[model samples]
Target: MMDYKEQREWLQEYLPQYMTEHLKDKNYSHFWPVLNAEWFKWLCFLTFPLILFQQRKILQWTKLKSSAKCPKKESTVFNDMLQPKRRAKSKAEIYSDIYYNKRIKPLVKAEEEVGNLLEDEDEDVKAQVHKMYEQQWRTHENAAKTNVLDDDEGDCMLDAEAITQGIDDLSIICQ
Candidate 1:
């Protein structure tokens, strides 16, 4: 029911009093230019992390809980687009493997490949995976564009044996 100006005043009054300087010390009273410059610098530097913390808190509070999210059985928008990959083994087998994955110390590629396989399919349930996929897509596109200039992969060969051995040697040996 409160109007805009009233709400603003209420917020100004409700803010912490001690942290905010007393009424007598609002401006240049507290060491003026030098102290104010340092305060401005500190505020500017802290804003980035403070905003990040606020975003994390908003995500934690506003986002749906795991059980409340779209279930695996129901095909959702994301599942339709990605054509979700199926699990290779039973849940028990996979759980057992994961329990050992840390102890056994999986290779990076194996761990990454398995991670891709285990991702959720439900649209809202899997936003983090989508962001990761987008990041990886950008990295791969950058690499491919750079590779054209660098020719890092050169011409691929269908048959390594033919390239390694001389054609003349093979023809003579066969005869």
Candidate 2:
């Protein structure tokens, strides 16, 4: 097996030649505008060897502790490229995470608490709780409206407000 230094030397020698040949091929003409740029080629030449060095270090570290047998394979130039695995959040999930968790959940809990408070026996207490609930709701709405004026996260705040508007309408009916 080639060590890290030998592998890096080989990549340094081979990558530019391979890139030049590949770019000259008619089949890859579509990518020529990006791939043929000198800076991009230089970046690749620098980045690939560093990636190989990291992989070799990780393999050496793992081999010290684990008895697992890794399958041997021929070293190809592109074989060590890193591909990240990510699960993209859906639109609804994005909205929920950004808006519901930060803003709506507290409002919901407060509404539930107010509903419970409305069940108290004294008329004065019920009136006070109702007024407090209305005041809190208005404050929340005002805050949300102010947030809509912000440049960052404004869209998310607007969506949150839209959702709360429906809830506010429902609360009015309930009262």
Candidate 3:
């Protein structure tokens, strides 16, 4: 069993050399360029939806097969049971849809949905500005309440002559 420090050291020494050798191979030249392209990023983005759609189809087929096999007892495939359950869309997800459509849609007068979308963004901006203003006002009010002249009122206050005299008195006292 390799400890974490030893494993890390081994990987640090070996991984770069492995990567360099792999990159030098003829097969990697064809594959490496895909990593830098926009299509590959889009393909990566689409993978989740493709996987979800496949899962949904499998779930439906499993239900149909199970119902046909035995009417009384419930029978389910282990593979189908192991499939990840799709979660309900959260507030963030709902917001993302609105945001995506707002950005993607054309700005045309006839399209009411586009007009409504713009209003949502404008309202959000206005609310954010109002919140920022309130926060600034609160900070300013708190700063005003704090005394800024405390050091000047105390014995710590001293002119250049006073400081020099105090240093001379300190030397005389020490002697």
Clash pairs, candidate 1, are none
Estimated TM-score for each candidate: 0.17, 0.20, 0.19
Off by over 4 Å in 3: 1-121, 151-175
- Local distance difference test values of all predictions, in order: 0.52, 0.59, 0.55
What tens digits encode model 3's per-residue C-alpha lDDT throughout 1-175? 3333543453345334434554344233443353325324433435354656643553354346433432442335985679776788999778778875675354443476755664667777878877999999999999988868555556565699999999999999999
- What is candidate 3's TM-score against the reference? 0.19
Evaluate residue 92 in candidate 3 and report its C-alpha lDDT on the 0 to 100 scale: 78
Model 1 deviation from the true structure expressed as Cα RMSD, one decimal place = 27.7
> Tens-digit lDDT track for model 1 on 76-126?
598678975575788978777787667544666678787787464677657
Best of the two (1, 2) by TM-score: 2
- In candidate 3 the C-alpha lDDT for residue 48 amounts to 55
Span of ten consecutive residues with least summed lDDT in model 1:
62-71
lDDT of 2 at 67: 23
What ranges in model 2 sit over 4 Å off? 1-117, 148-175
For each of the candidates, give the backbone clash count: 0, 0, 0
Residue 171 in candidate 3 has what lDDT? Answer: 100
